[model samples]
Target: MRLSIFAAALAAFALTANTADAQTRVTYKSAKSGSSYYQMGVQIAEAMKAAGDISVTIEESQGSVQNVMEAAVRGGDYVFTAPPALVGAARAGKGPFEARPSPKFAEIRALFPIPSLTMHFVARADEGIESLADLEGKTILLGKGSFGADEGAKYMTLFGLDGKVTVADAELSNAVGALKNGQIDAFVTAGSFPAPNVIEAAAGTGVTVISLTDEQVAETGRARLVIPAGTYAGQDSDIVTTSLPVVAYTSTAMDDDTAYALTKTFWEQKAALGEAARWWNGVDAALLDNITGQIHPGALKYYDEAGIAVPDTAR
Candidate 1:
């Protein structure tokens, strides 16, 4: 009887050890510290902890380009975020990826999309600023050292409005007040849809978000995004804009089970994630069409079971 009891205790102890050893660990590399994407890493780490036994460690990266470069040699358990375009560039050995072409670039597989960087051009509707051309005679604010400023300046030059429109020299922090008081005719900002600054500007003044025409979008050679109607106050129509898709990816070195669990947990917790941060609300399975590489076999399993269609290129 004592032997039987001893055997049962040994079995129980073994099970406990096995369970403890089952935890999966992943290293997630993304943007530089203090950026919104970096904060997303912290949020994702917390979500994984709350969901199950998986553990995620956040690592800071210079940017997406660096992320793709590192994936060339990083082994299993390494995950990172980057725009799908970079993956394509890496595969073709063009652009920044031209310097180094590794077969490992071919092994990169997509997991899922996070929030994108969407452009928003807030303009005073009362000033007859309904389109890009309308900005030709308007005074606009393009905050210094920002994506919006740079892009706005480029578009003005591209569309022949550079010398026509006057740029206000003001900090972005005061953009809303300046717009409300008519100090500036419009201002350009880029971020995820439902951008807070745009929201505040819309509510405070009769402002409209600019929609880039198909011709203009194509000319600019950037991805397109359409913000649904009713996304903001005083905006009753779709706002077409530019989008830079950000994606999560891993190398084939990671086994199917670990990738599957990670992908499954993400989709399952996406709603909760959106509740935590509004930017997450912009993510949807449809964005998978933008992923450049094939989907991870493990992540594909969850997509199939969940009835989410996979793009042929991604499969």
Candidate 2:
């Protein structure tokens, strides 16, 4: 009788163990190091850890393309990417994901759009370089690798730069140093200012941060975003041009329940999240309605329970 009872208890334990194991583990990956996406992801992972019992993990990855592939293949459940990349993948099915046609877009959904990385180009004040047009035939430290190359391309398109613009493949720090050493004519970066790298670059390099004029800002805002002053560190006195917004995309594969829980948690602790990510300061709880994709039913339920107005689209 004792042996039979022991065997029955062991069987029950096995069933419970299997039941607990059934709860899926979700993992997220972000672009390489020194990126806000990676940092915010680390913070979110911490938040998930604090939430308890939910098995979630966040890892560093090779940037948007790799991330999207991982999500498409189910190698990862979520990824932090940019709107252009997501839309490009979904609309053209040309980049990042091809085996899956653009129609397979439903495989991924856009969770939310966050502000872009504030980008700028800095040249020594004494260099006689005043406008984007002056970058012609000048050596500029664009970015570390592909990221830097993209930054350079954006500016080139923005200013319609036609001169010889030399780009150096260097990290932010080295890029700044290159400017100071005359190895490069200027340094450009897209990040929060007093961004450690920019701050270091400014200390003695006499770097002058430049941006588009008010009219330019207005024009760009029509196509993109233009930030008000104080968005980055040096904007108040050091930067002469208006700021533009660079939106980042979040992983959309989170189930309705998990998405709801995460969204609810994000708003509930808005204060703390804002403190961690400066851009969150602009997020209004009401903007929940403005989410581009369908809000998870769980999130919608949470919004209703919270008494927040659900936008018509959401409804």
Candidate 3:
């Protein structure tokens, strides 16, 4: 009888170990480390772990454009993206995705929205550069190995200053140094208001946050956003610019139950996460209306229970 009891106990332990090993592990792909999206991804992972017996891993990625492609290719279980336009473009095989469009792009689904990353143009206060046109004939630093390079080039073309201005590529820190030393007349970047690099540059040298004129804003096809007065030192008045929404997304490979759990945990613990990151303060349920892709059925399940209407187009 004693031998039989010990054998049963060992079998039970093996079953328990197997159950733990079988738990689903989700991989979350976030942008560059130390970015707001990375921090937010960590928070989501923690919340999902706390609310359910699941494992989550955070992986650093290049940026939104790359993240969307990875999600389409099943490279990761979750991805964070911005502007929402990238999603539409990837699905329709246009813009950055024009070369090799993936039909898998249509299987991508939205999870939630994060804050908008505002586009900022910084120039030396002494330069007398007041608008996009003023960038003509000036040496501008378009961020190295970043989406800003393409965006800066586009801005110059849109404003008819393409051939006139000398565009240079440099990392953020090097660009800041060049800007402070008068080597570069303007620097273009995009991120949450009062971006750390912008603040550092402003503190080191007098800087002007350039604003887009009504016509430029209209021509760019981006939403106009404002950096409220005094967001940074020497920034005395509100600066108007364009912005893109950051959003969380997943692929169809994610099961409905897992999606439901993650979506539910995200909203329930958002306040707590917001406490850790100021950028998270801008996350709003209303922004769900801005999502350009389909809604995951599991996420839709929770939203339906909450009486939040997801557009039929997203279904």
Candidate 4:
């Protein structure tokens, strides 16, 4: 009798173990540790966990360029975020990916639109900073090895403030405290609006979000963005800037059902996500117009069921 009871208990344990192993597991790769994108990844993982039987592991990355480069080795259940332009560049074997083209680039597919990368040229308001040209003569921290650093540097050069400004080599995580302590006069960070660092800076100290003129905005050739007044503490008027449309993506290796479940959960929980953070509100079906590559069949299925039309360019 004792032996029969022990065998039955062992069988029950095996079934329980198998049941626990059935959850779908995915790896979500986003930006560095302190970034808003990284925080979003954490929130997404939690939301997906609560929604159903799925497990998402959050991974830190240097930037979108690195994320795209790794897609070849990390196909199945690997989700990464990048601007649509980067996706196009990777597919064309141009830009950063030009060094070595991979056929895997052909397998890249859009999962969903997250948020556009909005440019914020934050400065000390007490210093009377006002425009892109004002950035000249200021010390700015644009962090190394990041899309923001590269884009910020490019903008400075494009707007003709490159040589005039002193670019600090500090990591972006230190940007707020550096600005608060007067260690740096300003910093240029790129992320969705109401960027966490920007909010902290504004609340911690007197700061100004430099507004680009129509001509400056035109010269950059990025999408126009207006930061509504009161989005932060010290701002009283609209601040116009530019943005690069960003999207979450995966490869053909991720099975259709896994991709489908991920997409469905994202859309279904987006509203609640937005209620918790305004940045999520920036994403919408209309933003699909900015996508440059094919949409995952699983994600497309969800879009069709919801009546969201994806543009032909992304088909």
Candidate 5:
């Protein structure tokens, strides 16, 4: 009897040790080039580590679509992505996933909401193009492959801009260069408040950012977003334009207990998570309510504990 009791205690110790180590080994996958997005992931990882003995790692990922697939396949543990890409992946049933159609769609859940991305129409000071309609006959560089490009394409189709907006597809870096060289009348990109590229390009070039006006803002809200004053390139200045809201998405492959623990830790250490990245500014405990789609049980539990009401749809 004494020997059996000693053996049981030894096994329990090993199990406890394994559980503790599991929390320390949290890993995430994100894009290296997108500083803002990647920074958030790092912050989450750090917060997780600081909450316990967890060691967090962030690996370079392809893009939004790729990241989602990685998380679905368990190739990665966590991921951040825009809404459209996440939705598209959940429907396709492939990529970083094994599910044919709904693979991990229901399992993945929202972790955080990011600032809206402004889709700016940048024109040369002398171009005389006032509205998106004015670029009918002029050459325009719509951001390519990037989210901005994909959104722009959708906007053109939605607004019936087929013949009215003759846009040339080019990589963001190349497009910026082309715009500087007068190869394209305008360079467009969907980005966060104070887009680094636009600000950098406009520093000395005298570029102008156009707004969607009240009507346009409402119209674009159908597929994208538009932030109010003081959210753009200038501080203490009003910038009225349409944007695309970004959300941080994580995989559903995480076991319920692990996800629950991390979710609980995240809320408990919310301050640390926000301090980890610039994009997290203004994020409040309530903003978690703004999310669409399914909510992970762990997140739901955390929110419940905080007295935050979870929508029936999310459940």
Candidate 6:
């Protein structure tokens, strides 16, 4: 009897040690520090860490494009980025990924979608730039080495402004200065409503928030969004524009069980997370429609068990 008791205790100790060792540690790559996306990433990491099954760390990055590339290269276990940006990079193998095509991009899978980010076109009110058409034959500032540049280039092409407007690449602050000094007529950017830079620019100078017409939105294949009146100073009316869905993704390197656990933990604790950040309130299983990449099998399994329909494309 004494020997059996001792043996049982030893087996229990080994089981506990093995269970602890099995906990997966993963690093989540987020956007620049102090940004909304970064805060969301922090909350997600905290949630996963609290689950007692996974250990998580957050790493700040330049932006969506950088996050996607880093996650694809094994630099991060998961990444947060705009779905359109990742889809575009993977499909064309151009832009920031121009040097070499990343066929591995196909292996990247979507996990969840955050709130949509609206595309904002800010132009000098004094420059007679009232609408997207006014941007023609003008010099525009697109963010240097970021998705803004890619979107700007695409917008110009879709709107038939290519060759009519000269595209200048610059950081947001520099671009604001150029607009103030009359160096650039307009600038293109995308983010959550009431973006700080747009607010600052509106406070400093008279500017018009250009809206895309319905036709333009359809042609661009972007969702239509409206920035409510008074979202920013000097903006007295609603601004109509297009939006892109931001999403969290992981590569195939993440095993099915780990992915399922992470996905289940996230959804199960989503209400708590939403309380942590208002933006998280927008995260729902329904928004998974915006995910353009393949869905991780683990996530699909979770949704399947929950009876949530998984799109054929994602599967």
Maximum-TM-score candidate: 1
lDDT per residue for candidate 5 within 1-315, as digits (tens), equals 999999999999999988876653666666665566676667777777777855667877666666665554663355556554455456555454444555556567765555655677777667776666766777877866676787677767766778776677667777667877888888778755556677665664556666566676677663334334554333243446665556666666555566667667766777665455444554545444556777767667777777877667777
Estimate, for each residue in 1-315, the C-alpha lDDT of model 3 and write its tens digit.
999999999999999999888777788886789886687778878877877766788989888788887766674356555557788999999998999788888888887777777788999989998888888889998876555566667788888996898877567668788998888998988876557778888899888989888778888877677777887789888888877777788878888887887788788878887777656655667778777878889999999998887777878
Candidate 2 collision pairs:
116-246, 143-148
**Per-residue accuracy of model 1 over 61-166 as CA lDDT, tens digit each:** 9888889999987989999998888888998999998888888898999998988888788898798788899898788998988667788788889899968988
Identify the runs in model 4 with alpha carbons over 4 angstroms from their true place: 134-145, 162-185
- The residue pairs found clashing in candidate 5 are 24-54, 24-55, 69-96, 117-191, 225-243
Q: What is the lDDT of residue 106 in candidate 2?
A: 50
- lDDT score, residue 233, model 1? 91
Better of 2 and 3 by lDDT: 3
Model 4 clash count equals 0
Of candidate 4, the 10-residue stretch with the lowest lDDT total is: 144-153
- C-alpha root-mean-square deviation, candidate 4: 2.9
Q: List the residue pairs that clash in candidate 3.
A: none
Candidate 2 per-residue C-alpha lDDT over 1-315 given as tens digits, one digit per residue, 9 for 90 to 100: 999999999999999999778654666666677676677667666665566544557777876666655554563245355544354555466754666664434545444334445556777767888778788888777765555457556657776773468766676667766777888888877654335566676676766667666676554442223445655444464344433332333334566776566656656656676787665565555434334444446556777788877666644
- Per-candidate TM vs. native? 0.87, 0.70, 0.79, 0.85, 0.70, 0.68
Candidate 1 yields a Cα-based lDDT of: 0.88
Ranking, TM-score, top scorer first: 1, 4, 3, 5, 2, 6
Candidate 6: clashing pairs of residues: none
Q: Cα deviation in Å at residue 261, candidate 1? A: 1.1
Lowest lDDT 10-residue stretch of candidate 3: 75-84
Count clashes in each candidate, considering only residues at least 3 apart in sequence or on different chains: 0, 2, 0, 0, 5, 0
